[model samples]
Target: MPPKGKQATKGQKQIQEENQSTLKFYMYIIFGINAAYLVLQYIFFYDSFTALYIILFLWAVGVNFGSYKFMSSMASKGIDLNMEAGMAEHAKDVILVTCIVQSISLISNYFWLLWLLVPGRAFYLLWVNILAPWIFAEAPEVDEKKQKKMERKMRRH
Candidate 1:
């Protein structure tokens, strides 16, 4: 390492701070919404396992969002080490959401599946709408190049 650079510029620092704050704001909104939903589930469903699952979902959401928010905040303050952990939490959140939905659908006698069709469509939504695109950020670009390379190599071979 050549003594490291001078780090982020002022504008970059400001943008980073803004991003962190926004992330935290989003996290708070998510946490509050989940919390309220849990409360309502308890009130309406009266402590059933569904309500319990809802509560667990809320906790998982909070952990995931809060972890990312905290990581962004740390990065704004010039700490980059925690960002990986935050990303891991976000990935975990995605998996947890799908797992919870699938498990609940199965355990609830396929009632939620009726909301979809057949069963386990929630996994499709979670994976396609969220995880697949997000997890492989470089997949699209890599795929185009890979296809071209494969075509050229096949022609040569």
Candidate 2:
């Protein structure tokens, strides 16, 4: 058999690949929604092509591309790089922070801003990029015995 360390590393690599694929899948869905919104806006509200709308669209595209690049680079980094040990908790913090920031932006609309200061597209990108690393990080490996036990229990249910 291959060396034990090599096997563990291979498993971790596989997990990272899976995580990256999941992130990419979600990114594509987000991009599709954004594109659909832009098309619908152009069709139903031709007059809505104001400076704010243009800026928002451009910004959304930039952020989406940037986030994709960032995630790809992060995924390709050495597996032992300085990932937060407590990634699950960090993921929760990221979500909470994104929500708070978005809330502030939304509340700012009361000041009569012509368009939303923080468009949903921007927040979506932020959320994806911020959470991706943690979501993809390899979890501590379970023992084979425990795994088989769990599998047997699952099969019984």
Candidate 3:
């Protein structure tokens, strides 16, 4: 049931359910692939690159998690850090670093599965760093600088 006056149609409800199901399906697939890869890596390449791969993977996870939390906190405080293409550059740098780790992991075929974490991370950034903040944050306070910019634009038109 919707709120007292808000009407949510059946189609909208269905779509939401479908999107959630799809997300779960994708998560299952990712988990399945990584789980299989881990088993194989343990069996065959246990001595090959396990130490370095684990270290690099842990490092990547730590960096991504830390940055996401920091950015999310800033966003929740209505401190929009997304000026210009700074966030885009940050995302690209993250992917680049992940790719570097992925490349090193490519020495073993089983480890190539870890490459999926790269795009997974990009999606994480889009959701956590970008979307969640804007969707759930307080409206930013417009100072004189922004007011003047808006006024100038209005005058131009």
Candidate 4:
């Protein structure tokens, strides 16, 4: 059998790879939806420059910048984007901004039917923003003292 240290390293690498693949899959879906929304906006609403269009465009730009900031903050913190907790937190922050902008854009454009598009995207965000990250979070390493304290607390409850 391999040394314990080697085995642990191997397991960590496998977890990293799995996390990376999952992140890539979700990113593709998110970007794809964004692209589709942009194209639809252009096709259906492109016309003489209007204040509403300008506002929507500005909001889109803000959302893009916000996403960049989110990624940069994670990098600055030395947080791996593939790590579940960090990824989920970032996703939640970005998704809230995205949802707000999308709602405003839909209302301004009077695309009532476009509201139908929201639930699926919201569901996707909810899953990645909460469920996936929680599931993938590493179990906290507990010292003997902490374990004893936790056991005592459990018994008291």
- Pick the TM-score winner: 2
In what order do the candidates fall by TM-score, top score first? 2, 4, 1, 3
Task: List, in order, the clash count of every candidate structure.
Answer: 0, 0, 0, 0
Question: For model 1, what is the error of residue 128's alpha carbon versus the real structure, in angstroms, after optimal superposition?
Answer: 16
Which candidate has the highest lDDT of all? 4
lDDT (Cα, 0-100) at 52 in candidate 1? 50
Stronger candidate by TM-score (2 vs 3): 2
Give residue 115's lDDT in candidate 1 (0 to 100). 30
All candidates' TM-scores? Answer: 0.37, 0.44, 0.35, 0.41
Scored by CA lDDT, what does every candidate get?
0.55, 0.53, 0.56, 0.60
C-alpha lDDT of candidate 4 relative to the true structure: 0.60
What lDDT is obtained when candidate 3 is compared to the true structure?
0.56
Q: What is the lDDT of residue 151 in candidate 2?
A: 100
Scanning candidate 4 in windows of ten residues, the lowest lDDT window is 4-13
lDDT of 1 by residue, 1-157 (tens): 6668786545666656656665656556555656665565557656564655665565556555655556555565665322444543444354345334433543463433333331255477678889998997784455778889899999998
After TM-score superposition, the amount by which residue 141's alpha carbon in candidate 3 deviates from its true location, in angstroms, is 30
List, residue by residue over 32-107, the lDDT tens digit for candidate 4. 5567666766777667446765576566556645665575555455455555556645564565456455645644
Model 1: C-alpha RMSD to truth?
12.3
- Alpha carbon lDDT at 46, candidate 2: 72
**Residue 49 local lDDT, model 3:** 50
lDDT of 2 by residue, 88-124 (tens): 3333233333333323332342332322433554567
